[model samples]
Target: MANNRNTSFLSDPALLEKVDKLRDLNIGQHVPLPQLVVVGDQSSGKSSLLESLTGIPFPKDQSLCTRYATQITSRRGDVDRVDIRIIAGPHASEEHRQHVEAFRMPTPSGLKFRQDFANILQKANEKMGLRADVSMANGTVFSEDVLKIEVQGPDEDYLTIIDVPGIFRTTTEGTTKDDMVMVRDLVTGYIKDERTIILAVLPSNVDVATQEILELAEDYDKDGRRTLGILTKPDLVLEHGAQAAVCDLIQGKKRPLTLGYFLVRNRGPNLESEDQSELDQIFRTQPWISLPQDRMGIPALKEQLGSLLFEITQREYPKLLQDVSSQISKCRRDLDSLGPSRQDEREQRSFLTHIAGVFQDRARAALMADYNSDSVFDQVQLRLITHVVNITDLFSAEFQQSAHLRHFQNPELHEPAEETVSSGEDFQGSNSLGLTISNLQDLLQATGVNDITQEELAELGEIIDLSHETTLPSDDVTSWIRDTYLNTRGMDLGTFNANVIATTFSEQSRKWGDMTKVYMSRVIVTIHRFIATTLRSVFPEEQSRRHLWSSILDGLLQRYKMAMDQASLLIEVERHKNPYTLNRQFADALSKARGHRITELLRPKARKDTRQYGELQNMVNLDDIAKAAEGKSNMEQQQEEIHDIVRAYYQLALDRFIDNIFQLAVDYSLLHGPDSPLKVFTQEWVINLEPEQLERIVGESKVAKKRRLKLAKKIQDLSSALKILKI
Candidate 1:
């Protein structure tokens, strides 16, 4: 009854053939295929079991043990046919693939097919360059490549099993410790795949704990959900009085598995018959018969494996289709990024021309401030015009804050104050100097200068902030200016020498050149970033992009240096050239400055007490005003006038300097001119390149070629798989 039940669902041709077609397409190499993989230690009857399942002869001797993974597939067909081939390993070079592909054997039929199987394997071994003896040390002892065999006959069952090299403990002749590790890694590689159902074959005569395959299965499938334990050679265990232990394992009393265990008796050296009756007869005789009847024969093992494979194939088919589709999309996308191949000079030039055209358009857009065109422009740093304007504004504001050598403060005032006179203010009369001073009407009225207006004081404060202003304090600046005025007093009396003021102005503006260089560097960096981003988008391949950069960057940098030199020369001329301005605003600025300073000096003489004057108006002291100017000489007043002239000229120069740095240096050298950096990689430049230069810049790399071929093959195989799956 048990035998009849086991043979009923042993083969399902329709479903199994679909999977066979997928495997034949080599889909398993890229993605895991639903199948059973047989694993065991050496001398564990693993080969005999495969022979029982496939009816093809496997080498039974220890010397001819499997040196690589063998994929044996048997299914029903009208005529008997046997085909063999090698699937190259991942690391196999092109030369090795050719050798593997060249291995062939003559077609044989009937009894002759079985007879030629061993010769076919021997030829395959030689083709793989495996050594014959452990001590030879000439050829590799193991390979990662796989040997695939397909057998078709009317009587065959629909089954596929991958048999890996049996695990071995110690090294033998011609084999070293490396071979052991290689074999272990090779076996574990197949068993660890989640899609494969592991078939662990163990010899019942040996202790089950000693079997390496079982340990590996436990490591990979700890819950034993997809692992099946097969105990072979129950007859040998009977002689050792270990039948009870084997029975315990079969009955789930020890080392139990979710899929349970099965006991099978295989053919001995003297017994060459392959039959389930022989196995049944031996189990019926004694203690073996006391084990579970349903789990004791080869037929039950085959039945269980068939059901498991069918179930897994059905469950994993949808996911397998999705995986194949995903791989196809990824491969095609990678190929697209590589662009079309260019083997010759004309093709290389054409490809480079296309890239250069794209670069030109992007750079033009950036220069024009049209940032809506490309996605790369989404980064704020890459927006050329906006960033340049922002940094330039910051440069101008910083110069306004720190350009002065010293900040002047009136010593008589309660708080430190800056002159707040506006250029629009009107002055009526002239003082002792040649400057027109405001508030002469009040001086003539003998009330000194009237109270300073809020509107007048707010004008200079609007242009520059006073709270965070940076410079030397009043005491240091006054002493320095006074000492210089006395030392340079040549042919002048009651006034400061003009050279002292000129020399002071030159020293105060020394920081402009260094600041301009830093500004230019920032602009260069921005241009380079935009160029690099354009290159990445145009040439997705790294090697080609690097070559093109080398070809064009020298010209761009030379232009930058030329412009930089011109800019530095402009600074040199400005520093050494006489301080002169043709603009008429300088006089108005100086007059307002004098009015503010004289008002501050006169305010100390006004009486703030309401008893002396009214609440809004202040009474002036003529004696206090004389003490404010001088008792014997007018040198302090001369120093005050000199300080006012320098302040007015510095403001005029700062405005002109900022404009020159942006327009003359950055715009002309890097962005706008015919030979500017933006014009370095135009289509005309590509056409002008010498043939050798074109090849040097655009030649395809070996790694890129290999990658293109790999992706192309992967896309082809996956497309075929999709068709086979009927998706």
Candidate 2:
């Protein structure tokens, strides 16, 4: 075996200088580039093969000579020879420089272009040899240097040949294994581009068609063409009489192999003439191998590589086009099968109305049951009466001690004017009405009751008696409480009953309202998100879901918060407690249950009374509502008015649960993009399901085989629909 300590192209100073120039030039930008990766078992002639191919013998010391990845390129004008450059990890940089410098000293012949490289390395080595032992922060010791060669052929096609450390030796050390994995990934990444080809070199004694090699060959063959394999030390095979057997193995078992193997003898002047003739015959049989006896093996291999490279380049063009076309076709298909159109929206509204009616019927039945069992309203009245009596008892002493109440007992109360304001100014309103009532109560307290006349006292007594007579008994507080809180709450909860009925009713009502709004908004937003973001991610489009979602969420939240705040302030002024504030707090709690935003709570409700009007408007096929108002068209005006009313109703509903609706929109977008194949399939299934089956699936019930069968039928229907749409 060769001493394995031999250093060749890596030591060439001229090549090193050329590598620097290539790096500075940035040749990676050029088109039709080739990445040539060299892979083999340790001491299996990987570097030797690269040296032979690139006309630059790489160092082959038993100690790892190549560590990390490296790149070598020729100077732009120089096509005949290459420049060597090293690519090392951050930790290996200093050590690699030293090795590169040491190799450059006493550069070999025919490396005239790398004269500057030789001087630079010599100078660097002499100055920094001591610092080479200085380790990087990472634990990895810089020991090996990978040699990269960039060859520019006469055709101006650039080929990058990477000479990696052998894989087998890497397993011996944990660190080495890590390095090997990284190197493998790097090599794989380069080769996966489809423009690159891997050249695997095997020793003559080793089997040419080992299972491992076959697997490697298959992986390397992106275009289904076996990588070129070289059988080095052909003379050894000739002496062992294994040449015919090797040939049989390669030709018969590895029948699909792209390039045939060649027998190469590395021995220089000592090789015999008879041996040379035998080598020539072997070369003749494997015309793919370029091995010249007169010249160094480097030139011959380079020539052969150039031809092989040209063939690979020709194949890549068509393949790239095919990949692009396939992607475009997929994008077109996705665009055709997206969510609800105008017709779909109308149908969905109708469906919602039907569902609402069902829920209302259930709610009325539950209410009747409560009514039959001492009625919620009656209980509420009794409770209010008891509360009034309790309040009177609590403040009875204060009422009796007030002399101002006695004097003001018969005082006339003035009402506000009934005439409408006809001023040009807009209506200005305040909470003064409540303040005025409070002031009147305060006046009665300040005055002494002894100042009042007997007639006035009799009138006050009669008023008090009337109030007490109108109030219900304390025993009926339950019915009154039910009327005030539970009935209002039960409007949405349907037949559900529990203790703390009012609180439960309120909570359920708020939850359902938010959920419904969120779901509806989510469906719409999901479609938008798919169109705006998801499709772009999958189809190489401009916009992304992340960007779209971020923008939409930011904008929607800002607007919704502002609107809610204003609405809350108005409600607080009118009702003495901020409704919007309470709604927001409720929404926050509801979101915890749903684990999502509740933006859908803001969607406007369609008017039930305007169903006929909506149907008539739909028949008119108005493209734009604004256009309908032009030319004094009464029907168009009426249609516009109806639309405005619908919009107002929608706005009111949305105002009640904006957070939920917005959240739903975001969720919908995330779930229905082009990249969301699962979501798309799910949506398709939902759209195709029978009405009853869909209801069951969406409802709380869990039916197994029936559900599965229904789901399967839905999928089938969706598939048929998609087929019709050519999606």
Candidate 3:
């Protein structure tokens, strides 16, 4: 490594050009670029100082000219020539762009410093719509773009400067609120760069308290370490007792900066602009500046800046490489996350297909209830299962006790049944309640009594109350109880028809539609979820893809909603179909209930029948015992059949409806529908996309693409620069 202490080594042209190239690529806005940044309020001799440094009479008009950031860079070269260029900004107007483009193209005529450049700047204002007589009420001025001027002459100091727009207290005739803000932001953009050293220029003639640059500098660099205060227009400090204050300011007695201050005299407007030697002689004549010759002249400031920048560069050059590498890695990672650039048809095809396959795998997993998988739709599957289970369990419990199965529950209807007196003397009177099931086989052979009357069943529900006459034996007591229930067995007269069954389950089965809504919501949610996650991951620029996905999903979501509505409609249609309990296990349930009740009632401890061999067993009279047994048997059988019918009907109907409807929902719609997100792509759809449409889908915004390209180039350039650095 060369000794950085040597002035020649510190001022190496190659070393300084690395940062300049980054500036050209415009990487400074993102990653900090090491340079001297000049900032001051309007009329603070900012432009004069830059002109003195670069030896160019840059336009001094604040409103019409020099309103953009100007980068003046000088490198050591024998041919004293100037290279000028404009880096157009994202918001640059037509006028500014035209001028920039014209400047970029080669002219048949050789580059003329005076006329051609002046024409460009003037025409630029015209393009920006700045009036010859500018005013603020209807102001339209744009373009915060940079104008770069490079001067390379023999033994030129390797100094790079960022001269930004001047700050103003108030907008004048031509300037608006935006103009005021634009200038400040433009200046702040440069100074806020951590790697750039702030050259805070303030007129010595004005009070330093009013300077806006230092206030802004303090915001970004609070310690005032990177800030160097330059007191321009020192000649204007000839007022009453201002020279003493200026001298104190220069000597660091007031408003102290870490690098202190420099008092440089820009040539007064009336005087011919003096050369470097002439300025030195002029500065020596000044009372305030002559005392501190080392810190009062333009030459001294150049030396200080060169040393300062060199030291900063030497310290930060390695970090610059690291910063570039870090940004590059970030951009690449983001690009990778966007998957890949779907620029061509083939890439687009592959990108869309990959996303589709991923969505399909996830959707299939969800459908199969594979919650154990780490697929995106695992939670959806779990939630869906929970919903189905909960709804089915509730619906099953409800269906069992439905009103339509009431007669089935209580076997013999006991209300006003058809009454008839048989020709045979065995039949009851015409006015008797429902037909008696006094003899089961006879009722089955009927006096036309297929169903026992509700009246008869109610009448028979009564049990004869018996007192245990004179403390009879337990056998006698049990026998009496058995005989009582036997005499009052239930009778039913109402016919079990489709209307009765419909009334029973209509309310319960009506809720099948509600279940549709609930399950449909889950289905819709999962579908939407798949689309959202898939589309969101397709591109790094969420904003770019949002419009396209939103358009696609708008119609899709509407269709899905309609499909779900139709599902509800189909369920409603299913509800309107006459309810019927078909081929239910009525006989089996009746037999099971009868046996269960009879066994429960006639258990050994509770029975009153005489024992065959045990003498210790309690015995009732044989005739009474027979009557007791017959009575209990009849009562038990009648109740059993009713319980059996209700149980069978409930179980069958409940199972069928839930299984049929829920299975239909699971199979038919969302798992497959609004065409399923997986099948939403085609070769031509992704491939032959219009540019405008592609912009909505995956194409990068022009500004963002430009920024990425700039960063990528900067990385390449910085990597090349890193090769030149020995350390």
Best by TM-score: 1
Regions of candidate 2 where Cα sits further than 4 Å from its true position: 1-33, 70-160, 173-175, 209-214, 220-226, 238-241, 249-255, 267-301, 317-727
Compose the digit string of candidate 2's lDDT tens values, residues 239-274.
334665655534534444555544454433244234
Q: How far is candidate 2 from the true structure (C-alpha RMSD, Å)?
A: 28.8
Model 3 CA lDDT for position 194: 74
By summed lDDT, the worst window of 10 consecutive residues in model 2 runs over 403-412
lDDT, each prediction: 0.73, 0.37, 0.58
Candidate of highest lDDT: 1
TM-scores of the candidates are: 0.77, 0.36, 0.65
Ranked by TM-score from best down, the candidates are 1, 3, 2
Q: What tens digits encode model 3's per-residue C-alpha lDDT throughout 1-727?
A: 1234446645465667777876776667557878898888878888778867766665566545566677888777767677767776645555665666455422222235533655656655554444533454443554566777776767677788888777888877767798788777777777877788999998988888888888999999998889999988766667658888888887788878898898787765565556756755656664754467778688878888887778787778888878877776776665455455555545555665565465555545555667566544333323333333433333333332221212232222233122211111122322133333233224223222223345423322231111111111122322332343344333434322334333334433444554445445434444454455555543435665675565465455555555565666666655665644545465565566555544443443343544667544534344543344454444354333333443455455555655555555543544454454334543445555565565566555676565556555555755554444433
Q: Between candidates 1 and 2, which one is better according to TM-score?
A: 1
- Cα shift from native, residue 591, model 3 (Å): 3.9
User: Which residue pairs show backbone clashes in model 1?
Assistant: 134-173, 134-174, 134-175, 135-173, 135-174
lDDT of 2 at 575: 28
Candidate 1 ranges beyond 4 A from true positions: 1-14, 132-138, 273-280, 290-293, 333-375, 404-508, 521-556, 579-652, 678-701
Candidates 1 and 3: which is better by TM-score? 1
